[model samples]
Each structure stands twice: as C-alpha cells, then as structure tokens.
Target: MDSSGAGAGAASPNPKCCVSLSAFYNNTIVPCPNCSCNCKGLPGAKCHSEENAGSMLQMPHDPLQEPEDLVRCTDHMCPIRVHWHVKQNYKAYWRVKITVTNLNMVRNYSDWSLVVQHPNLQSVQQIFSFNFQPLKIHGFLNDTGMFWGVRYYNEILMQSGVDGNVQTEMLLSKNTSLFTLHEGWAFPRKISFNGDHCVMPPPDDYPRVPNSSTASKLSLPVLVFISLLPIIIFVGPSHFLDYL
Candidate 1:
C-alpha cells in the first residue's frame, strides 16, 4: 500500500508504452518519424512501415495486470474504511453498495468522495443515498484501458457512516458476446476515499448472514441424504444378498 508510486504528476516508468492523459484526451498522436501507421486516431492502430514498426509504441498493456500500478494501501491509521459489496449480479447488469465509515472517535468529514475503476462498465444507472444528495458523479475512460467512476458527497458526521448504492449496466465489447464474472467482475479493483486509498480488509474479517438461496441449496441435499440414510442401512444388505 505504498502510495508514493501513485500521484497526479507521477512519471511513467515506461514512457514509450504509456500515454499521458493530456496527450490522449486531446487526441495528440506522437508518431514515429520513420513509421508509416498514423498514431493519430483510435488505439492499437498498427504501423505498416517495417522501418518504423520497431519505434512505434506497441499496444498498451492492461493496467490491472501491472503490480506496481495496482498496489493497495495497507495502512489503517487513516480512520476511514471503505466497504464494497456486490448486491446483485446478472449477466449484463449489476448493483453495488459502497459504504464509507469514519472510524475516528471525534472527527467528522465535511465532504468526501469515492473513486472506483473498472474496464467494462457501461454506465451508472442510479446512485441512492438516504441522508445526502449526490454532489457529483463522473465516468470516463482513459488511455490505460480502464474506466473510472468518481462519486462525491457532503457531510459524513463523526462516528457515523454513509452508503452509496449504485446500479450499473454493462455491455460486451465489440465482437464479444460474453464475458466471465468469476474474476473481480462488478467489483472495484481500486478504492479511494477523499483522495486516500483505504484498507480493504478481507471478506472473512466481516460477519455476514447466509444468503437464502445458498441456505436452501445446502439444506435440500442434506434433507434428501437424511431421508434416504435409514433405507440404505436397513435394505442394502438384504437386497444385495437376494440379488446374489
């Protein structure tokens, strides 16, 4: 959770592979003087000229896969905890609950915001809160193949918490009809509160009531096994002997 590696003006370790947000948003393409493929348009355009191929920037790598960029803060002294929950998950839609708690004994946060990032999020359908009005919400894609959603709210009182419930819908990328959700789907890979990354404690650290569906699925198998156990014990040996 060393955040020194992440900052607004942080330098890119690999300049050739990384594009600045300013350059990308302005559609400024720095083409290799010797290459033929223009870097001025969409991402991943190839350089047809063999001479310039080596100099052209290769396709941008997935930022999530990079360890140094995906670092999570382990520091717990910040007195705030951000909890993310996937309330409902579907093939193309999902709902999320993000709870921000001020764990400080005597301090209150006048204004705060949560920042979350994903790769395939389409849009945030709704943001609900019981006590506060939504101040601002922004969603945008950058050159790093990551989409970011930032939400702002005002007034979280001392020793209290607030919940931002968001419903979002997603769509597949072009030429792809399906994607797997087993790997961190509909979950924020990175979370920050008021510009500081918060500790993401493990799920086991929190107590949760069992879901009804899960309980029913488990109970049905146990009930069937219990009902058949006596029959198996009383009838198995006799039936085997008769068959023999």
Candidate 2:
C-alpha cells in the first residue's frame, strides 16, 4: 500500500519514531503517534506480582491469530517481544513504546489494531493510530515505529491495507490507567488468546466433506463410456453380418 496516493496525508515521519534504547533502563522504545480516546481502564492492572506472571486469564482476540505473543514479561498466551520506555516520571504521565511483529502467514492482514488497558487511573488520554505502509511478501512482514506522539489510550486501531512481510512496531501512551496493553483484532474470524500469542483455533467440531472436491466433480469416465457404446453395437453388426 503506497502512502503517496489520495489519502496520503494520514501519516507523518518523526525523529522520535525511530528505534532507540531507553535512557531509563535496559528497555528500548520506538516512536509512533497515537490516537486519543477516553475508554475505561482494565480491571486487573492494579494488582500484579511475579507469582501471578504465568497465570491464565480470559482475554478478547481478533478473528485471526497473531504469530507473536502480546506481552513479553509473562508466559500467558501471545509471545511477542514487548519493550517499555518512559519519557519522564509517572507522576504527570508516562509514554510507552510497543513493538509487534507478525510471524504467521496463514491469514491476510486487514483490520490489525492494538488496545492498552490501565486500571489505576482517574482519567486517560486519547489514542493516536498508524500502521506500516503496505508491501508484499512471500511469508511475513514487520513494522517498526512508523508514527509517533500518539497521545491517546482508548482502543487504537491501525490503518488498513498492509502487505504481510516481517517485523512491525507501534507506539502508545497511558492516558488513563496503570498497566495493561493488547494487540489483536476481531474481524476475520474468532481468535483465542493463550498469553504468548493469538491462536485461531479450528472450528468447533465442524464436519468434514466426505470426498475431495477435486475428484468428486469429474465426469470423464461417463463421457468415454457413452462414446464407445454405439461404436461397439454398430460396428460389430453390419460389417460382420455377412460372416455371421
């Protein structure tokens, strides 16, 4: 998807949107603009512990499963690598940089998006949204910080029309709650979240066809038999009548 077309004004490049290691810690944050919204905080971000790190919890997912996990610090379901960066102390507000890469090629990408939930805030900021410009790939694709300074926290959805290739990144900030971030969609099909990655489970006990569609649609044998039927009956009679 070329960004040079009619709707090209949607994306802008920035210095902060490039890949940079965090000055605070071992963390690294990529820059990407965010969309703003005032959605409520997630319920479970208030209480977190190392003991509850690997615990399983129910979470919503997009129709298609993502190849990488959403959270990196835990072993829940989606297993994509997650990095954290802070522009300043958490007193006023903090900025978060998140990176998500596609590792699966089974599904075509259309409505890819991310949602971050914070449970410890009285109010939240708006969420700015952007996506990697589209390109073709034999298998996978990646987007690493194509937009920056997004300023919002509610459901942030990426722009459509992307070519699946390998490695992608998106940046977000917490305008409302304490800590909870998600990346997935609900469009193509129902997906299941296992913590490390989103999984598209096979249909629930859907029945299979009795025969292969390729073999079942053949009519060659019937036509051949009909073509030879008259030849065998006619040629054997008139020509051999004198001999019989």
Candidate 3:
C-alpha cells in the first residue's frame, strides 16, 4: 500500500522557490539566497523603513560652493548697500556693526551670503538677525578676512514685494591697529555677496571720530598767561606790577 501511494505522485516544494517571511508580510519579493542575480526587490521598488525613508530623498551638497549664475545683479538695476559703523573703539581693539541692505525695489533674493575683507578683522564676537535678536551664525575669521554663508537659519531673504526692503546686521570685534578709523567709522577693503561686490556710498556720510587733541589745545587765557610769564621775566618786577 505504501509503494502504491508513493507511485501516486504527491507534489514536493520547488528548490528554486525561496521567499522570506518578512518579505511576504511586507508584500515585497526578495531574491533567493542562492541566486546570482542579487535582485533584492523590484527594480524601482524598495523595502520601506523609518530610517531609510528619511534618507531616501537626500542629495549631496557642498556648502562652500555656490550655484552658477545664481545672482544677476549686473542685469538688474537693483543695488545692495553696505554700511559699517564703529560701535566701540579702544587702543588695541574695536567693535564694529555691519549693515547690508537690499535696495532692490522689485526683485527678491534667497540663499544670500556675504564676504567682507578687512586687514584688521580679528574675529566675530557676536551676531544679530533682522529682528535685532541674537542669532547663532556660521562662519570663520582670521587675520586676513572673514566670510559667512547665510543659510536658512540666518539667511537674508529679501521679499521686496511684501516687506518693501530687507536688511541684516552683524557685530564684530577687530584689531584696531590694522585698520584706520576716520571720525568713528572704518570702511572695509571690500564687501561682496556671492562673489559680486556691493555698491558702497562715499564715506562722507559715515560717523567720524572727534579729534580729542583739538579740545586739549591751549585756550586763549592759558596762552595769554604763558606769554605774560616770558614777558614778566624779561621786564623788571616793578615794570610787571606797573603793567598789571
């Protein structure tokens, strides 16, 4: 009876058919473990996971490199104004406030960055956003210069249509001996955004440092007293008393 049952031909599972239980549960087809094709799933499909889903759409980017022809300032009549002020002045160091204003009446700017070159810029001690609140900024400064690539957190996006204008401010400390301050304001050697120089008005409008020595000069009374001393010595005491 056993021999007759064997001859009846009950089907056996195929050796080529191999599918994981997880794959079956997830409704995905995984390649057989022994297969040479190494096909994990459908060509365009993937097994979804929380970690993988978060990274699937990521693209590589270099923060230092800017996109080509991102700014067309030459073609547009819009202008970017750069103004700087000396907030504090000392013998060795000074604090400066830099203002960048987008004077573009019609266009909007996004992903903007600024580069300022100064011989005496030592470091950036603090930064402020458009709201006049302290903001964490990313940049570096050395003896030669300083640069900042403004991103979403601190980027200046001037929506000319809505706000009418946009501006950003930065406060920095510099080595005073490296730069010359006329009046109380000092100008940077160059100010640029995305490799294009911004338009700067004449320094005549900036604040000036008062000449401290001018006030220390001899007054008319003091000068007269000094002159009288020499004359008093040349003349006799009786003559000086007579003149008095």
Candidate 4:
C-alpha cells in the first residue's frame, strides 16, 4: 500500500490546480463578488478569488432573491460539521466505504456527491450517486469501491433541502487516494445540492495512451529504422562524403 503522504502529498497554490482530500474537504464555496462573468453569478465561474473576505457570489444556478429553504442546526449535540470514518479491515478491487452526517436540526439534503481521489492512479476515479433527501441522523449514505492501493482523504459535497440551503460536509479515506481530492473542489462558497449535477475536480494528470495502441502503430520496419540511429551516428560522415 502506498503511503498517503508520499508522491500524492505534493501541493500547488493555483486555485485551479487540484489538491489533496484533506485540503479539498476542509474548505467551503462562498459566492465570489468580483467575478464579472454573466452566468447567473454561479459559484463555479472561472474567475472567483479567495483573498477578499465576506464577499458573496451566488450559486451558479440560484437566483438572487428567490425564496431559500432555511433550516437551523439545533443539534448542539452533534454540531454543524462534516464527519466520516473508514474501517481498517477492508479489502476488494475497490473496497472503501465512507459515511457523512448532516447534524442539522430538521433538514434533509436534496442532492449530494462523494469525491474520492488519489494522485498516482488514473482509473480509480469514483463519484457515488446522490439520492435527494435531508438526512435526519447519520445524514445520507454513499459508498465507493477501493479501486487503487491507498487514498489520502475523502470529500462530501452537499446541497440541502427543497431550497438547497447546503449543509456541513466531511472528508475521510486513506491519504494516498485522497491526494488530488481538491482538484476541482470549489471553496469559500455556498452551494445548493441539485440532483441534476455535482461539482468534480478536473484530472490532475491527463490520461495516457494504451500500450496496445502504441504496439499496433509500430512494426518491424519502424523498429529497424529507430535501431539504426546509433550506428548512423558513428558511420555518418563517411556515408555523407560518398553521397556528396
């Protein structure tokens, strides 16, 4: 198992650059007031800044003065925060299970998505399906297969209730797979959980061409031509003089 703190732990400061699960899950998406794009002031606009404080950019799909379904967190007992844990004794091709709790008093989530990412591997990206419902106790349930070796962290994105007020989310998972969790996560912004869509961080690395594709393109003649480079370098000038 790869340690979550190794190659996957590297960090970059670009907001567009993806980050690990721990860093990705810890932040919130607030509205960006400086964004001038005319796309209904949604949170995912490309030009939002994190430096300014208390400035709100509305949800990309939400209207400015529309009625919002407001729910208060009376669960002083549970508190308003994201919580999650993974069992150590787990195994499979991808056997990772995580749970998130929405400790709000009387609210259920309308839409939610689970973000699990790793830095080293590409085939293991998994975003669990979201079912629209405000979680009363343990919040909504979402589980993903353990696809790769290890994961660094996990992120839960939420849009709550009928009006999509949003709720506290959590992060959990092995540190290795969690490395690039923040690749596409939006921060310092509030979001409405819409069943129709979920925000995903772009790939930290591009996909590689398959070995079979490369093999099919190269043949015996091509191999011989490439192999002659070294011999040509040693005997080149003599052959060039003869040609001249």
Candidate 5:
C-alpha cells in the first residue's frame, strides 16, 4: 500500500435545506425557514402541490423504481422534516410527540431510524407507536436514544402524500428537584434521521416557558393565604388551632 495519499478536494459542507426541525411547544410552533432550499434551481427538480399530494399518495410505491428527490411544495422546499412537540405537562410526568414527514414523492424508507438526545431521555417511562433503546454514552446516565418503527406497521415510511408521515409520543417521569420547563429544557437537544444530522432551529427561537407563567402559579397560593389571614387573626391563635 502506498503511504502517499491522493490530493483531497475542497470540503463540501452539508446543505442547510435538505431537512429541518419544526418544533412546537406550549402554544407556539416554530416553523422552518422560508425558501431554505433552492429546489427550483436544481436540474430536473420536481415538486408536488398540496392538492395533488394526497392523490399521489394513494398510488402504491414501486420498490424497483430508481431513486429521485420528489418533494412536496412548501415554503421551506425541503424534501423532509422532523417535528418535536411538548404535548402536556403533569405533576409527575411530561409528554412529548415526535413526527417525521417524508416530503419526497418518490422516496420511501425501510428500517428507518432516529437518534435523539436530551437531558431526561433516560427517564422516559413509556413510548407509543415506536421502539426505543437507550444509548449509554455517559456511563449509566444515558442521555441519548435510538428509535425506530414497529415492524410490519410503520417500518416503511411512505413517500410524500396525505399519509406520508410517521408519528410517536412518549411520557417521561420527572425528577421534580431537577426538572424544569424553562429555556427549552423540555425539548430534545438533538435529532438525526437515517444517520444524517437534522437542521435545528436556533435557541433564541425555541418556545420558552416564560417566568410570568411560573409567577402565576405562585400567585394563587399566596392569594389564598392572604384571604385567610384576617380570619386567623380575628379568631386568635387558640381558636385558629382548634378550627384547624
């Protein structure tokens, strides 16, 4: 084997428009950037309109057909997208929903996989409509997970159309002492599709759990205590203790 290596060409960076993360939290949905991909400029690029997308999806996919990028027409112009949503919060648990959409009209994936990272992924108690395995990267405190569809069900992600998406929801037990919803802490830190890293929205754009909401929670209890103070004083300590 020759020790001298061939000349390496200039590095070609990853495209910013191939895929994006569309996140929804609380009452806000963070959308992908407009016109992120120059699909129109690409030679032989094709896009299906919203009205035709549903009809095209009804057709059976051809397994032996040649691969091509057939994306649906959207503001982002990407061939695929990933969505993360914070569905609900409970006293001891929180819920999340992840949806993966294939905008390509001609591409269907088999044995697809997703890689996710977040602080509380190890605390996930249950997952619906998907399979999950923890990735033990940091000793016993695994913060990463690999997810895939249930076989014979959503294992094959259909091409772009009305039902060209797969979805799953999960519940994670919260450690009250360490859990927080603020600063996008409730959302996934990173996600990848089929080994390709997805483009994430900037931190400043993430849906925030504002301080006003937390203050509102505290206000109610303080109001109740204030209202009862006069009664306690009027009844005296002895009467108040007996009433309790």
Candidate 6:
C-alpha cells in the first residue's frame, strides 16, 4: 500500500478537473461551468492521449512514491466522468442509464463502486448488469444505493480506451409525491465513485423537460374526443361511413 495513498482511496486533488456530464434520453446535453484545474497551463503538467496508452502501461509504478496523473486528453480534462441519462418514461416507472468512464490513461480502477442518492431509488424496480445494494441514509428506506460491477466482469474499471467504461440501466417506480421528470428531477441528487467526491454541473444547466411536451399530453384527450365525434355522428349513415 502506498503511504501517500496512491492507489488506496485515491481521489482528485482538484475537483474542478473532474467535471461530469449528463444527458436526457432525447440527447439534450449540459456541461459544467468554466472552472478548471491549475494543471492546464502550469509549467510541469502531464497528460496522455488515447494513442499513448500502450507506453503508459509500460512505465514504472512505485507505491511508496507519489504517482503521476496520466489523464486522457479531453476538452474538459477530467480523469473520470459519470454520465447519467434519463432513458424513458413508462406508465408506472422510468428508466435511467449511467455510464462511468475512465479518462486516466495510466491506471485502472479495481473493485470500483458507485454510490447514488435519489429519492426514487427507494422504489427501484430492477437494476441490470451491475450488482446493487441499498444503503440507508436516514435510518429509513435506503434511497442511497451502492452499485458495483458483476464479478469476473466489469468490476475492474479499465483505463481510458475503447474498453475503458462500464454501464448499467435501472428502472425505478415513480413516487407520487416526488417523482417528476421536469426541472431535472430525473437527475440524481448526489453521486460519488470510489468514495471520491464528484463534481456536478449546475442545477440550472440540467436538462429540462420541455413545456410543449406537457401541453401536448394535456391536449391528447381533446384530440381523442374530436376524432371520435365524426364516428358517433355518422355511425347511422352507411353512405358516409363507407368512406371510412
């Protein structure tokens, strides 16, 4: 074990460098604010692109020494990012998909797990691919959940590359009092990976369910009524019904 905690519970020194992104099932996207880590323009910063992953794997690793951060090249420059997507709405439930991406080209994460806090998690119907356990937050139903990859599968989050990600989908029953997809209600209230505090985008920047969608739903009854009127009024007229 590294006395400095290199591979043990390692977290981002600068939270600003680990911004996460989120999207809606419709693919509406949002990004974090402009805050960034000091590594960008400093004299001695190190980074690796997807192409150099082979060489990075060959470098010496010393647990006793402080390890270098060989993060992948990205526009946000985050070493890891968790993407949450609200996938669909059903009559009694909604679906979401979460993806954990590794942007650090130098290291892989072992025995990684995710902790998520959301009100609907208390009523989770099913979770796919990942193993799940509910964690209590207030001595009540565990709205906070611990998720990890299935054994001999994705438990080891790979280094950045074509195979550097793990993903899972969840179905949660709607809470009559709290469930609402509008105003970013679908986004998790809190999220963490490997015990590291993650940076989240501003709530204002979260994806919103457009007002028009609500309006369209409201008008559906009228549309159905209108469509049925001609059939009711003309059912008795065989000549007019023949055109239908």
* Clash totals for all candidate models: 1, 55, 4, 38, 1, 0
Task: Provide the global lDDT of candidate 1 against the true structure.
Answer: 0.36
The runs of at least 3 residues in candidate 5 whose Cα sits more than 4 Å from the true structure, single-residue gaps closed, are 1-25, 35-46, 52-65, 138-141, 213-244
| List of clashing residue pairs for candidate 1 | 1-73
lDDT of 4 by residue, 1-244 (tens): 1111112222222111111122222243221122111232334322222232113323332333332322222211221222222212122222223334332322333223323322222322333432222222223323221211112222222223233222222222334543332333212112111111122223332122233456578998888767776666877956744533
How far in Å is the alpha carbon of 173 misplaced in model 3? 5.2
Q: In candidate 1, where is summed lDDT lowest over 10 consecutive residues?
A: 16-25
Q: Candidate 6, residue 213: CA error in Å?
A: 6.7
Say what the RMSD of model 6 is: 5.3
Worst 10 residues of 4 by lDDT: 188-197
Report the C-alpha displacement of residue 162, candidate 2, in angstroms.
Answer: 11
- TM-score for each model: 0.38, 0.24, 0.45, 0.22, 0.72, 0.75
Give all candidates' CA lDDT scores. 0.36, 0.28, 0.40, 0.27, 0.72, 0.72
* Candidate 5 lDDT tens digits, 128-157: 999999999778779999998898899777
Tens digit of per-residue lDDT, candidate 1, span 1-244: 1221122233223221110011111233221121111233335432233234333324454555432121111122234444445455555555555555443332344434445554443454445552222222453452112212333433332332233222222322321355433434434445454455433334332323334464476677788776677776888855744533
* Collision count of model 6: 0
**Which candidate number would show the highest TM-score if scored against the true structure?**
6
User: Which has the greatest lDDT?
Assistant: 5
Better lDDT candidate (2, 5) = 5
Report the C-alpha displacement of residue 154, candidate 4, in angstroms: 19
Q: Which lDDT value does model 4 have at 14?
A: 18
Candidate 6 Cα errors over 4 Å, as ranges: 1-13, 16-26, 32-39, 43-45, 52-67, 176-178, 213-244
